[model samples]
Target: MTDIRWTLKSKAETSHVNNLAWDLQVSDEIANLLCQRGIKTFDEARAFFRPNLKDLHNPFLMKDMDSAVARINKAISCGENILVFGDYDVDGTTAVALVSSYLMQFTSNVATYIPDRYVEGYGLSIQGIDFADDNNVSLIIALDCGIKSIEEVAYAARKGIDFIICDHHRPGEQLPEAIAVLDPKRQDCHYPYDELCGCGVGFKLIQALAHGRGQNIEDLLPFLDLVATAIAADIVPVTGENRVLAYFGLEVLNSKPRPGIYALMTFQKKREMTLGDVVFIIAPRINAAGRIRHGQHAVNLLTESDYKNATILAREIEDFNSDRRELDQLIKDEALTQILEKQEEKRFTTVVFNENWHKGVIGIVASRLIETYYRPTLVFTKSGDKLAASARSVKGFDVYNALEACAEYIEQFGGHKYAAGLTLTEAQYPMFKERFEEVVSKTIDPNLLIPEILIDDEIPLSSITPKFYRILKQIAPFGPGNLQPVFISRNVYEIGQAKCVGKDESHLRAVFQQDGSDRFVSIGFGLGKKLDLLANQKRVDIVYSIDENEWNGSVSLQLRIRDIRPSSMG
Candidate 1:
């Protein structure tokens, strides 16, 4: 068992909730949720629910937007051979597809390039520059990468290739000398929203180019499906401009999906899709190309205009995804065994390695390990002459900072607080692992090691109505920073039936009520073992999210239980 904590929000904000609810003619609970999301006034609430495209800040407001726009247009005017380059991930591949497809509408001189993950590694590579030089490409548009590629950019410049970088990762101390660097995370950049995924940054550059030519924003709405996929896959914050983009992107996906997306949807029985569907279903298929083989297949699938051709590409990617899952599970199981055999379970951090492990799935394995270990984790695999690793951290802890403290043993490292990538000499692995554990143990807050369940509000079972459920879903397109609200119901007791469910009896299905109130049905996935707690207890508190279940042409509210424990009040 693991430690769990419940953090309740302050009730002092209820008065503000009441005022906003009265003004907007909504319930006090809905108003409370709105205020919690920083929507205090009626206007803010309206804007939150109905995001407008005009509300998007002018692309020129981004740093270096003018230069980037001018450079692209000049390339088009001169008919200079332009290459769109990017990393071999979903974000990078989608960014490449977006810009290349958009520019192709204006000029036939455009081409796209994605560096091979094994050949040149990540970001702008000298091999990519050499390829550009040989093709007589005078301009290169690098997306999702090149923010830290000072030497590569300079090398490309010497070869008569100008660089326009559209990246969103945090920048280094000294910027690269490129024709234009358009990253919102630069300390000097004042873009209102800095959490844009790489494709979102690429969209802004194209948006600026369109505006410069006096084109309508509606002309570019078709591309939002790609932007929305990137936003969800990259795990960027779902607030501000991103929320607006995702909101409309879902519409495009549902109403008039691109040929490629439509082809993928044919495999599913569902008629409508959401951001979560894109993340779990579509994003994985795209990412599979990069992980199991090359990302070019993903680009081809995204940009293909013919439904028949896209169907063929989707089949190939499906095979890649199947192979990736097998490898991911195999490596995870091996890593867990290694930890047990080495007796490192008591360590503050998890660091495991195997030279034969596939590098493509290391990041996924790192995340999988965290679900069981619940601490900072790193999974290492042999890459060329060095050992490369992917790092992941639990909530509230900065694995990047821990890596920074142990930078002496690292050859190269880069990424954000929650996730990062690093490489180190084979001889340095032991020292690096030791130092990482020490740093984390000494500096990490003890409470952060335990998992947390944030309860948005405490409500009774009677408060759950069709109207309440309807209003709750309006705040969707949920992700980080705008998570699905988790509500806590106290003094709940089993009413009719409680038993293990599913084939292996790994789930729990029950009916619950409080203070002889209305009965409500709930299903707890993977909570079958908790049946003993309910058998011995009279009352319990449950943390759950309200879900609407539609069965046999009827709709009713269902509680999706997240966790359960004996009632503290009792």
Candidate 2:
């Protein structure tokens, strides 16, 4: 395993930390965390800890909110058939479900459409638009995609269908000629917060429509479960308006969620769910609907009103998730083996292709490859006559920009700086791969090639009182911008012998303590190879996040050790 670089965040001003700590009656450690999150005052801290729906910005403040709202209302007033079109991913499907369900309150002509991943690829597909035409749809609301479908939007226009696009991806130079193009990332857009996911953008449109209809904000609360899921699944920043949305969304998800969401919860015991649960558990199950079968299943599940029907859909999605897991692991192993056999480990980037690889799982596999190679990765599979790929980037690197640099070889591409998808002809794959590696090698900072575990602070374990942990827990709904804080403790020594655990002995379990601190039990997944370093009572520095463990009717705090290394002093 490659060693992870531990970079501790710089301390906030001492006076600010001390003042906040005194005012909040929290440990300096907690105060510093708040300060790092840009919360230096009592009011800010209160707002951060207690998220409020009222904190959400007025939807009209978006670049094209007025236009988007007017178009939707016009369609509703006319009783025109309206189509809600979206991509076949969690973000897109959730957006479709959210917007389409909201519109159903005003009119019954609303219909939802999710393009097949394999047949339609992504974004506004001709098949989807043709379906709208066949159904006599006069208005189409595109979500999570359509930011770059300039030509496709024209195709819809030629058929007398007006489009209202609610998307979050970076746009191409020319936008689609829609009735309204709502994207915070647009060059001309000046929305106060620009980090909303696709479903969040959909939520804003509904917020505007509701405002125009004089509906109370409470009327929209039920839809937040879907928003929170998208916010988690899309990996957007959990700060500002997004923080408020996610905070309330989590509340709705845990209590009185839509039947579809309720059906997906398979935990043995009911527990207070966190964003982590949404990311690792709920998001994957929802995504499995799209990846293994069809994304329409997810939209159906999210929009289902009956619990029994939702459960049946949820069961089908669960089976899809199982099949997806099998394919993911199998392909990930094969890709890794290819890298070794081809001796491509030393390359600046990883671009592997196989004609038979499943398109649905290549993105997941690309992310898995990064765990070992720690480089920009692209996993390719044959899709029709062309080759399709999913691109994943290392921290601080922009894979999208690199893709742009190699745009000549790409037939189509879209995504954020961290993750993207692209398609190209088979003949162009070699050139694209070579150009991509060349582009990343020359432009990327060498430091980014190594994985970084950014530590929020270096605090002694003694400071980890129950009260401190309580306050820290409030600093969540954690994600990209406001990540769960990681801490580093130095000169820690193992008290009990460390032992490998889990399947294939891939995890390490041990008991450790630092000078003047209580002993902590730690579980380090994927750190089993480092167990030898913990032997012989050698001191070491550890990076970890505090996690709660429950077993045999007992609960205790444990270190979810992220990385371990020998003590620098030793």
Candidate 3:
């Protein structure tokens, strides 16, 4: 299960050419990728490469938006108490920060509440509502969650409190009875884009606020840094309007980062930041708050009014993230053992459980199992009388829908297409597991069980140039659907080979020559095991991403090697 082989499939160039000819000003390979991604016209290509805030659809276009905005405006005007309730993940924390900070400008009555990860679980809870009521809060804004909380929203509504739901998760057949349920996934929603993260949706709310106040939208552009971080961290597709948000968000992240980000950058030694930097360095720190403790730590860090406090909180979060990494690795190792022991079944799904596994890290563990096994995975741990589990799906399988099939056993569940969370009674775990496996075995194509590494395009090593790399960089803030361009070169000769080292000789550095004309340096992290295969072969094919690497204060263009194999002898 750990050594799943990835196969490369190359589509004919004609189809790619036909797809890109109308829009891209590039060679056939780049155009093919653009076309394959449905960028068919010049305008579409332009917008895809350069996302702007101006391109974000009017927020008022969402169903119930008018009511949501009016209620918020009334609260601001009347000086009524308002509470912002959010989940405990990065997306939830950023959404809470976006809405609460925006509202603080008009009224001090606004305060934020983040559910304790260990104590309260996710979304709007009756306890949260009662707390808001006790504080005399008349308005509640639920961010990043609450799409499926029909009961909780109804309870809050009955208490003479109004609710506004700004969420991105898929809603159930019956929508919540909140005053305004603003979700793009709503069947009636006509918003042009449907792939926003929770924080991205929150950004739209702020955008609407700016428009209502007749304020310049540019004034809110700085906040894109946070939106971009959430979009990247939440694993949302960075295409369409999200691309624009993350594109501008990265610029703000690198140029004029707020205190929280600045402190994180300094701590991580990330002098120059990119979307990848945010994904790898900054995001884990932000997420560590919810994983190891309460997400309020993250919210406080994001909205820190004092510079000194922000620095202290950033360092504290970094330590927490480090601890989380250790815990995640430990749990992942243990879960892998449990999975391997049951590999004889050859099943299409993996469901592993343990009594004492940390509830906070089950999601992370499930994600790791998915990467290794390339199957729909669920990691469950005992929680009270029920078993709480986190589920992750492969490319074609929808874990949320799969969970719905077993809803008879599930006490509660919510998440996106790829990731979800659920709770079920301990007595029903075995039956639900068998039913889930049966459902997946019947529905999933057997071939998709193997992980596939999709190469964006095939290219000649000679085709790579500074100009081409520059064009590629313009498609910044790559994530999920909009990925950093990957290129495959065939029949490449190994000019030189050595295990250039980092973090315990874990990386391999080498030089490659194609057609005996062009030589390129390539570095493969954790590919030292392939050193012998690379050295013995005279030539090989490589999958790589073009990058500029800075080493010891020197910069040079190089290939970040992804995978390689012997050249086809045929």
Q: Can you write out model 2's per-residue Cα lDDT over 1-570, one digit (the tens) per residue?
A: 476778989999999899999999988899999999899999999888988878899888899899988888888898899999998888999999999999898899989999988998988999999999999999999999999999889999999999999999988889888889999999999899999999999999999999988997899999999999999999999989999999999999888888888888843244567998988889998889889889999999999999999989888988999999999999999999999999998999999999988888899999999988999999999999999999999999999999999999999999999999999999999999999999999999999988899999998889887777787788888999999999999899998668999989999999989889999999999889888888853799999999898999998999999998888767
RMSD of each: 1.4, 1.2, 2.2
Model 3: per-residue Cα lDDT at residue 133:
91
lDDT values of the candidates?
0.90, 0.91, 0.84
Candidate 1 residue-wise lDDT, 300-406, digit = tens: 99999999999998888889999999999999999999999999998899999999999888999999998888899999999999999999999999898899899
Candidate 2 TM-score, true structure as reference: 0.98
- Each model's total of backbone clashes: 0, 0, 1
Model 3, which residues run further than 4 Å from truth?
A: 2-25, 341-345
User: Highest lDDT among the candidates is held by which one?
Assistant: 2
Candidate 1 clash pair list: none
Residue pairs of candidate 2 with colliding backbone atoms: none
From the highest lDDT down, the ranking of the candidates is 2, 1, 3
The positional error of residue 386 in candidate 1, measured at the CA in angstroms, is 1.1
Two-way TM-score contest, 2 vs 3, winner: 2
